[model samples]
Target: MSYLVFEQVTKVYGAVEVVAPFDLDVPEGELVAFLGPSGCGKTTLMRMVGGLEPPSSGQILLRGERLKKPDRRRGMVFQSYSAFPWLTVAQNVAYGMRYRRDLSAAEKEEQVQHFLALVGLTDFASEWPNRISGGMRQRVAIARTLAAGSEILLMDEPFGALDAQRREFLQLELRRIQQEEGKTVIFVTHDVEEAAFLADRVIVFTRRPARILAEVDVTARLGASRTLELREGTDFFGLRNELLHYVRSTASEEEGTA
Candidate 1:
């Protein structure tokens, strides 16, 4: 079985469908990105995988087991800094473990501290959300998600709100973390370049009521790890332009049919 599978999936609200029927399979330990423009159902698809939303029709399976509701098996990072303003960074990270019966208070503290350091925020553990910069807050969000120890991560443009430099920095940091931990991640972003830099494969989607337009495997010479230099190469643009062309062609075809 695939590590993650979305089989003949569709989502609808009343009479309007938000996502067309689609099938996608992600292999174990792979990082894939769903790339498209705004309102193209990328976030919706991520939400389904995260168990925050259910498909109107079709099945979502992880490791061959059907996913029916939210569980700690999947971690998620939102585009917004979702930390509670009143809570300390440590408190924010520990919030995810409230339902777990396995960890003692000492163990939870240890895990929280470990994750805080993982995201380079051990020094700010006692600060409230408002005292931190936007980038730092985003790091806290990542640390919180990581602390949950979930095997799969569903990220919805986690660095979208940051400055370009910070976003790029975090992308490299995320690649390092994913490699060290061997986690399967599905990241959503509208930026094609971002997808190319971070993904093992990129799934491009059509506009509203989105469906997979094309799936491109990037064959850049990053040599098993992502790097900024890879993004500047000719091969990167070649793959990216191909995806852009496919998306445009699909959009035009849909318009013609309508």
Candidate 2:
């Protein structure tokens, strides 16, 4: 059975439907990227999975059980700087664990340290969020989410604000972390290359009333090694171009109809 399943899920606001009814199954430990143009309901679908927004119709199932509200099992990392300015890096990362009655103080600290190291933020553990760069803050956010023991991660363009160099670096780091930890991730991104480089499978969406246009398996083309060298390969460019074509074609279709 799939780890996460969206069955005939639809999202609407008033008379307008943003996400048309669609069905998708994401296997355990797979990193799936939702790629499309703006207002394509990628983020909206992610939010439903995260339980930040309820689906207007249909159900989102995790492990065959319907997900009604936000739970620690599914964590979210947003594009914005979500860390608290007043808290230190370690404190921010440990914040989510405070609610867990199952973990002792020592266990929480250990988990925090472990995840911080995974994101290469061990040295900055005592530093405040404002003291770190944008990329570092996002790292802290990811560490926090992981520390909460979330099996499914929903990231909404977490690296979209970073510069080219930092974005690329974080993309690699995120892939490494996901692989090592064996977490299922649903990432929303507008960047074609970002989707192609990071996802095991890329799910392309159409305009406003979003529906799956295609599912491109990156592993078949890029293989398991996600190094910087892979980005320079002809196959990578081919897949990237294919994703871009989907986005552009969808946009052209929308414009023609409008």
lDDT of 1 by residue, 80-141 (tens): 88998889989999987877889999999999988888888999999999999888888888
List of clashing residue pairs for candidate 2 = none
Candidate 1, which ten residues in sequence have the lowest lDDT sum?
Answer: 218-227
The sequence of per-residue lDDT tens digits that candidate 2 reaches over residues 231-255 is 9989899999999888888889867
TM-score of each: 0.92, 0.97
- Segments in model 2 whose C-alpha atoms lie over 4 Å from true places: 256-258
| Backbone clash count, each prediction separately | 0, 0
Please state the error at residue 188 of candidate 2 in Å: 0.1
CA displacement after TM-score superposition, residue 195 of candidate 1 (Å): 0.5
Candidate 1, residue 96: Cα displacement in angstroms equals 2.2
Show the lowest summed lDDT stretch of 10 residues, model 2. Answer: 249-258
* Best prediction by lDDT: 2
